[model samples]
Target: MTQAMSCNEAAGLVRSQGAVVLHTSPTTYDRYVSGPGMCLLDQTTEPAWVRTADSTQCFVGYRCRAIELEIGQ
Candidate 1:
């Protein structure tokens, strides 16, 4: 199983890799991106908050979510 990482580490991965699938818990994971360019045509980039080893809610990078979904939020 993938181990939890720090916010800085996660951010670094996104910066260097452009996109990454980060696992916050054993079953919880999300795809993070360095910028909106990585998102699909129907998706937009939003702040991604996740639990890290050193913080409960860390701002690592951006997450791609459907544009329509974000509009309702």
Candidate 2:
């Protein structure tokens, strides 16, 4: 299931998932394209095996089920 997460939490999740995390923002025309275009903002800060597409415009991680996320109020 998907959930709304803060930037900090997203970073932590990326680290634990053994996935490469990147921060990105689209260029002027890139933002208006039918498909989104992403500009890399930062390089990977942690070790991960996930390969990100060049179009990636946000920091995201991926990995097998190891650590579970705790949800609360």
Candidate 3:
């Protein structure tokens, strides 16, 4: 987060910090987190999106927040 890193680095960080990463298109991003263990890190404002490098119709959201992944009891 404080420095540049690859996807693997980010994934490792997520695993270390007990989190889950969800990649989705504009239509599916918000809807995909409905299940338990998934929470929007910040709900006070609308999430932001960053376009993919290929210029494809895909983007990453919630990158700046701490999304928590909980486990089922």
Candidate 4:
């Protein structure tokens, strides 16, 4: 089952495995090409984990289950 995790946790997971999508801009979210999870750039924002040494864009953590599923777990 999908779990409620901090953005920090999600960043780690995405960094290692990859996410279905990496939300950058709200309007651009749907436009992102569906492919391998985005590389978590060092966005200087919150959660601290996603922050890297290059990028300043930050993805604040989510409070809800960030992932959506089609099958029952």
Candidate 5:
């Protein structure tokens, strides 16, 4: 229900809040974090690339994905 944000704005949220749920689109969202420390024991941090109002491929922060999936890649 909110407007799309800039890369800086999205990156700032992770830096300031440590972890937050970010919505790229009305129906698409994911949990982003400042670092791996914020991820679960069974999860690992991965680069979060998203389209923002100002950039197409913005590196906002990291996303928490399954550790096994990360290793498998």
Candidate 6:
């Protein structure tokens, strides 16, 4: 049986699910120069699990891969 989890709790769940996880900080910021002023973007990279299913919930033995984003142009 699989356990219900929140977005934050899904980090450990993803690992236990035999998925490749990419963990990051809570306050991930990206600063870039857009024309004149600088643009500051804030996001969360704690842990996002992507599985092979369309449903929101996944089984315990499910597989997931954490997504990575590249900053800068």
Candidate 4 residue pairs in clash (backbone atoms < 3 Å): 42-52
- How many backbone collisions does model 3 have? 0
Residue-level lDDT tens digits of model 6 in 1-73: 1123444344444444433332222333111111111111332233222322233532222222234467873
What would the per-residue lDDT of candidate 4 be over residues 1-73, giving only the tens digit for each residue? 0123444544555455433344343333321211223423331222322332333433533222234445975
lDDT of each: 0.81, 0.31, 0.36, 0.34, 0.82, 0.31
Candidate 2 colliding pairs, count: 0
What would the per-residue lDDT of candidate 2 be over residues 1-73, giving only the tens digit for each residue? 0123454454455445433333332321111111111222332122222222332223443322223346972
Model 6 CA lDDT for position 44: 21
User: Among all windows of ten consecutive residues in candidate 5, which has the lowest summed lDDT?
Assistant: 1-10
Full ranking by lDDT: 5, 1, 3, 4, 2, 6
Error of 1 at 7 (Å): 1.7
Candidate 1: residue 15 lDDT (0-100): 87
TM-score winner: 5
Tell me the spans in candidate 6 whose CA falls farther than 4 Å from its real position: 1-4, 20-73
TM-score of each: 0.81, 0.24, 0.27, 0.25, 0.83, 0.19
Note each model's CA RMSD in angstroms: 3.6, 16.3, 11.4, 14.8, 3.4, 14.1
Query: Per-residue lDDT for 70 in model 4?
Result: 58
Candidates 3 and 6, the one with greater lDDT: 3
Instruction: List where candidate 1 sits over 4 angstroms from the true fold.
Output: 1-3, 69-73
Q: Which window of 10 residues has the lowest lDDT sum in candidate 6? A: 30-39
Give lDDT tens digits, candidate 3, residues 1-73.
Answer: 2123344443344445543444343354332221224445443222333234333322222334344457972
